[model samples]
Target chain A: MLLMIPGPVHLHERIQLAMAKPMIGHRTKDFSEILEYCTEMLKKLFGTKHDVFIISGSGTAGMEAAIACFSKVKRITCIDNGKFGDRLGKIAERYTEVDVVRFEWGKSIELDEVEKSLAEGSEALAFVHNETSTGILNPARELAKIAKKYDALVIMDGITSVGGDYVAMDEWGVDVAIVGSQKCIGAPPGLCAVAVNDRAWEFYNEKCPFYLDLKAYKKKLEDWQTPYTPAVSLFFALQEALKIIEEEGLENRIRRHRELSAFVRKWVEEAGLELFPELNEYSQYSNTVTAIKMPEGITDKELRGELKEKYGILISGGQEHLKGKIFRIGTMGNVTIRDVVTTLACIERILVKRGIIKPVLGEIEA
Target chain B: MLLMIPGPVHLHERIQLAMAKPMIGHRTKDFSEILEYCTEMLKKLFGTKHDVFIISGSGTAGMEAAIACFSKVKRITCIDNGKFGDRLGKIAERYTEVDVVRFEWGKSIELDEVEKSLAEGSEALAFVHNETSTGILNPARELAKIAKKYDALVIMDGITSVGGDYVAMDEWGVDVAIVGSQKCIGAPPGLCAVAVNDRAWEFYNEKCPFYLDLKAYKKKLEDWQTPYTPAVSLFFALQEALKIIEEEGLENRIRRHRELSAFVRKWVEEAGLELFPELNEYSQYSNTVTAIKMPEGITDKELRGELKEKYGILISGGQEHLKGKIFRIGTMGNVTIRDVVTTLACIERILVKRGIIKPVLGEIEA
Candidate 1:
């Protein structure tokens, strides 16, 4: 089955079978051994030597923890480009005083705007490395550099970027990088992993809620345990997925993503449908799935339904104002060139059949 | 390895193999189908037609959500018989304006006190059926009846009781029953399953926080979906565990627990160790692991550490004020009579070596 949605991607059978197995006690020496090994492996995946803590919650939970832990920072600057960016601002606002710098939907966040926002002497800046909603990827490293100039901590929402892209957590000057299992990790959701730099640990120790407190997670992770009952089954799958990632090599994994994204981009151009995202310095991982702005009379949901119901392809529909106007196809994690080609071919057939795009004879490569 | 802890028993290769499988999409039709069936099966396990909603969190998450959703309650009465009961009170205090009825750490909750507390006017009375921390099980049915008399809702913390004893949800008039997958359900600890009666639903709809909102969970559960990326792996593990419970028959499972608990009780008596809990009203599932009150200079932790390190057998020490004052061994789950006998023998050896208790004269039953 084609799984082109932003998350809950098609997983390998190893992960599936792992979920069906018996569980070990979290406090047992055996589970701790696995937890210790998995933590070390994830640190390698995150490109951090500091520490990787796993929490049994969604990505939002991790975000909440990050925001809550830095309460000493009186003002948190949130870079709002799309849906996820707006959510970060909203969550930060709930717990801490936050200032949001907004941008138009489907637009890449300008580094200059962030630079100007940081001029206010805010405590830190929060930005989404990959905005899954509009397929816009911010230049996180550049933003991190700008934030560093102001001596501010940079929190990157690398939820969709980490494994699919070259995040370079330690090399990028990113203080805190948050990622989820469901996205590029190619595992099920429910496990949110956050890597805290030495500096961020200081922030965490001083300011945070009890549960979202980073220091608490760190202390627990040191013992190779979680503060709560973790998603052990998910942990098993991640161990396997990370092993596969290691075998492929991080650079090779990123290269595969780039190849698949480029293939997807080629098809969109051939279809002559305008790409929704302004792809200036966008995410290489997802390549920012394009919204096919069809002929004026075409119905967006109908096309999506045709592909999903008839062809059994599950593509993501647009959110909010972009609803029924855009359909996104993710290109990440175990998705090969062949998978991309077939999916695009099916999509092209659906478009031509719907009379939205003129059928070009043998334009699609099988 | 000897695992006599309350949960996370020594898993068979089959259950461990089940957990090793990969994850599936939570929203996709495939995951929804599996989730739907799991929900139905859980309803059967709980002996209720009430809607079952699964959250990807620890059993405490279920308790928090239950408290969070029942936001309209003017006062929730938390009955504390032991450590777990006290923990429930602590959690309820976070969301609901709670009224707590206290009992001594190892003492049983008096039905008269509970009935009197209900008369004081509370919207809900929350109690832990099996207080694993102190191994004291409250009379849930009688409390449920008394709570119903005050026009109050009944929420039972069945984290250690649901799968081990008789939990007649509808028959016992329980409005909300919270369960953890790790205990009697015989799965890993990720998802929390809750059964909410209609009256509880009304309260849930009135003022629940959006994320912990039971109404939201109910909507998703109906369609076999979840609010967030579920602990996909644990869900399937739970599915298999529930199937085992069904095949064995609920009565047979409960009887096994009772027999095991009785066997452990007999061994403790033969060893001349004093039981910590009220024997008149014991948890049929887990006989309160007694505090030997150690002879002279011996500490519980020192003895427990030696037993674990020497024999690779793990037992639990007491919590809070009771820590290092008492030791606990839980008899429940897929554990057999042989395991009970083996654990008692291990304890006997540990006690004799430490000069805390005299070595047994007769051999234990296999």
Candidate 2:
């Protein structure tokens, strides 16, 4: 079975086997060494000199942790263009006065609008680097520059972009960057990684819940440990996954993902499907996922059901307002060109069965 | 290495293998089935008819979630006797007005004292069923009865006791009980399980943090789903761990833990060591772990180092005030009589080498 969800894409066998290592005491020297080693690799993958920590949670946990610890400002600006972006805004609203700069779900973030919002004198600006809900990669670097001009700390939700795309937290001056283990890391789900720079540490809030407190995490990091017992198996998987990423080289990995995403997009167009996000000079499609409008007269449920039940291929349907209107295919993690081609073939077969399009003579094999 | 920590106990190979399962989309039917099956097994293990949900976090996350969702009352009483107990009280202090009933560490909870506190009209009584810090199993049934008499809801931290000891949440009128995956459940750390009874749901607060909201969890439960993406691999490990528990039978499993704890205590006595807790008829020692006073002239660091470096055995030292005064041995989660005996043998060997104890004749196999 193939899993092509926006996250938890697909794990390599090596990373999966790492989960089978025997349990070690979280306080033991062996685990300490492992924690240190994993932290180093994570720092490299994040392309940051800031401190990196592995949190035992999904991507949302990292987002909440960031909000819980750093949103002490009087007013924070959140750019919402997709589900994840809206989620960041909602979480931020709970802790501070939030100014939400909204955009269409499938549209790119307008730098001019964000610059205007930052001009309102906010302490922090939170945005999603890659909006998986609509397959749009926002211009995080440019937005961070505008935020820095206003002296606002930049917080990014890089869950699907960090590994698949070029996300340099330090380079972009992102104060806090959150990534998940299951997306492009090729690790199992259950671990969230966050890199926090010194600037972000200034806003630490002790009033935050202890479990999600960044200060507590920072203190524990001194001893190469976490405040709580993490999912040790997931940590092991992450370590192995990071090694794979290092061997592949981040640049090569980004290029591979770009090629795969482009290949998938080309297939979608040939199959008479349209990309959900509008393509323009400023619009950058996410390398990790591709959102496509459903063919006419075909419901998302029927298409995804047939893809799963008949072909053992699992893709994701639209979420929130876009539900049943579009579907998403993830080509992140260990996915290859063959996997994408096969998925496209399966979708074409299902579409043909539904009489949505005529098969190309050369594309259809005997 | 042998892991004899209070939690994150050694996992069985079968449970470890389950963590190696391929990634599945959280929305897939396969995942829904796994969720339903695992939830059912967890209910059986928890011995409660209440709703059980798997949270992707350490046990502390479950504690915070319970406090966030169920602490809408005017006042809640937290019975603080050990480190974990005090933690619960501290977390409760953050959510609502809290009345703390304090007791000495390594001491039992006096029901009369709790009754007096509950008389002040608390909406809920929060305490730890088993205090891992001091290896004391509080009288959960009696306390629950007293809380019920005052019409106060009962919230229990069963992190280290749920599967190792008898935890009849419904039978004892426990409204909410939190357990971790790495303790007697014999799964890796990362996932936390919470059993929430219908009565506790009445106090649900919308102001609670959305990520930790129980209402959202329940809404997703209708379709055997989590509101956010969960640690899927940990869920697989948990399913296998629960199956192992079912096969062993909870009664037999509890008895095994009791026997292992007893064996370790006997060895400590023979080695001229003393139990940390004051033993009396009212004093119920935890079946899952045992705390022993450090031998005279032997520092915890020295003793633990030798045990770990030479014998590859790992035990835990005390926390906070008890640090350097006592050490703990865990006898839960896939641990057998043989493992206990081996650990005891290693300790005896270390003591003999340090000239703290004379070697027993013929006791050494060599």
- Candidate 1 Cα deviation (angstroms), residue B287: 6.2
Query: Local error of candidate 2 at A48, Å?
Result: 1.7
* Per-residue accuracy of model 2 over B117-233 as CA lDDT, tens digit each: 899888899999989999998988888999999888889999999988888999988899999989998888999988999999778866666577778788999998998899999
| DockQ of predictions, in order shown | 0.39, 0.78
Every candidate's chain B TM-score: 0.92, 0.96
Error of 2 at A342 (Å): 1.4
Per-residue CA lDDT of model 1 for A1-366, tens digit only, reads 567777877777766666655555577667787678777877876778887777777787677666667646778899988888988897677556788999887877777778887898777999898888887667887888899999888888888888887788898898888888878877777778888888885555242333355676778777777766676777777777787787888889887776777766666677677767775663332452434444455667676677777877677878778887777888766666766766777777877876767764256543
Top candidate by DockQ: 2
Docking class of 2: medium
Q: B1-366, model 1: which lDDT tens digit per residue?
A: 666777765554556666555444466777787688778877876779888888777777777777667757788899987877777787776566878899887777887887877787778899998888777767878888888889898888888888877788899999888888777767776778888888886676343333455776777666677866676666667777777787888889888887787777666677777667764552332532333334345677677777787876777888788887777886766777777767777778777876767876366452
Native interface contact recovery, all models = 0.53, 0.83
Q: What is the C-alpha interface RMSD of model 1?
A: 3.6
Top TM-score hit: 2
Error of 2 at B90 (Å): 2.7
Evaluate all candidate structures by whole-model CA lDDT and list the values in order: 0.73, 0.86
